[model samples]
Target: MTSAIDIAALDPASRDAGAVAHYGDPVREQRLLEEKVGLVDRSHRTVIAVPGADRLTWLHSLTTQHLEKLQPGQGTELLILSPHGHIEHHAMVTEDGTTTWLDLEPGSQLLGHLERMRFFSQVEPADVTADWALLSLVGPGTDEALAALGVDRLDPPDALDVPGAKFAQGTQPPRPSTIYRVAAFGAGWVRRVENGADLLVPRADKDTIDVEKVGLWAYEAHRVAAKRPRHGFETDHRTLPAEAGFTAPAVHLEKGCYRGQETVARVHHLGRPPRKLVLLHLDGITTDELPVPGTPVTANDRTVGFVGTAVRHHELGQVALALVKNNVKDDTQLRVGESTAQMDS
Candidate 1:
């Protein structure tokens, strides 16, 4: 799902340019992402478009969210699960009257699953990543930045019957991009996540917009601090939404049947997930290199879990997200590789 355009190259100060690791000043960038504003390149993500009259209802029946009443410009997240309740796919969804748009991490197989379940439905899911590039603006300066781009404010109107509203074609009045607390994108779509706004712009027009750029390190540090779990980083093949605090925003417990509703309901009413996610504060003095994901997390010399996303925060020196045995005591001392780790309070 990566774009041909190297978005990291957009930052003149970027180090580890291939992965957009940092802009030579990770702490400053992290501060910008937290207090001011920082733009992040996410063109490596994927986009999917599902068009047809039955798009919303079709998605509602197949995923973990209640999307049948979804309005145009409104945004929500959904998870596709295995019949046994394991999370298989996750996407941020929004409808634009004529089509349902899905924003997913790279390598998501949600599109193929949607197509296979189209037994006579009017929906047709197609990969549209080639036509779009994703970018994000984080921190308190988002509104000001959007205003500078001629997007006065984010107030998406109700879904109208415009045929090409998404891309603004055929003389249709330019439709506002989807907004959930934030709005962006002039020729594509936008969605807000926590304290940031993600903009998807046409590939040809992406470079036209001007903004201060940051690297992936800044974003990851903030995400780890916020306790937000990501798809690939926080999940494994046997992951359940409840294990990562994904049940509230990503699942609708009482709506209707989905691929994995049975397992979700059983876990909710009968028992707790075997593992639970926690934030860990690492003892930086114990190691020079930060622990990477998949590093074994041990309690009393016994492996208890594995690390997910680990980062050096601008404020909290070193932090990480990990999945540990639910039975582990809250006060237990833990170790991440050679460093002493404590549950972040």
Candidate 2:
């Protein structure tokens, strides 16, 4: 087997630290993410494959998405919750008849959970992260890039034998049948290519999609603007899908029993979630004076939530994502330490 390396594992000194630094600095990252299309190595995430006759049915019973209705070459977002309904992991699931791949954060507990679940079924789940390389192609030019790759439409849910090298359109509902997964990045698209193959394909004059290098800072800015939560930041084992706004497409309330179904259903139907995700626009802040993650956000001299992500927006100044208590209303004024910020409802 070929050895695989995580992009995050690369030494900062050896790699382009400037690019990653661009991700940490919001303004620079957003400019690159918005004005041009860029590529980021996502090999740090793991890919697990489920194969055999019972793969779809088995997964359907274990995840939040309705896998039974999923068509080959189609993909959907999934949240694996704990028995208490807290998020364990978020995944992008894709099916190709012979195999269903769950692409999740590297070292995520979902892989072990799925592995253990396999003992009760005949389906085979194998960690295939080493066999594939994942790349996140974000920005406005994403669709055109996929078009340059020969995928004109998203593969329908019912379609079989769809090419593995297919591209899906931007993240939108009832996503194009040819696209695999609808992503949250601004008009973003994800492309998965098997290892050992040339990812860059030949294109005509009008079809050429230039792969610009993007840093993590830019990706972070895009994520904050879209109000999408990250695993370790806004989401964790303590957070339920509802709290993180994963209740919609990421969680299937009608799906059969899974690890955290009861709690998710209970919170959705009977009780209010303890907290809600909110966007924060920091006031009177300078790029050098940005608040760090975990900085307590306070309102009326009380604690609400901590900053999850803080980005110095090129256009909007400083913005952040926070999981504040539900009582916090939109336009609520909150303070991060001594800095003032407003909650964007």
How close is every model to the real structure, measured as TM-score?
0.85, 0.76
Q: What is the lDDT of candidate 2?
A: 0.63
Q: lDDT by residue for model 1 over 1-345, one digit each (tens)?
A: 123334256644333244466657778889988888888877667889899998988888898877887777677788899999998888877666777889888756777787889999998899998897778888888778777877756643233231221232343222222125334357566666567677878977765667777878888898899998988787888889888767766776656788889888777665567889899989988687888678999998999988988888988888999988888877889999989999863
- In candidate 2, what residue range of length 10 has the lowest lDDT sum? 194-203
RMSD of each: 9.0, 9.3
Q: Tell me how far candidate 2 lies from the true structure as C-alpha RMSD in angstroms.
A: 9.3
Per-residue lDDT tens digits for candidate 2, residues 254-332, read 5567888888767776547899888898875433476766788899999988888787677877889988899888878
Q: Which residues of candidate 2, in runs, are more than 4 Å off? A: 1-29, 155-210, 284-289
lDDT of each: 0.76, 0.63
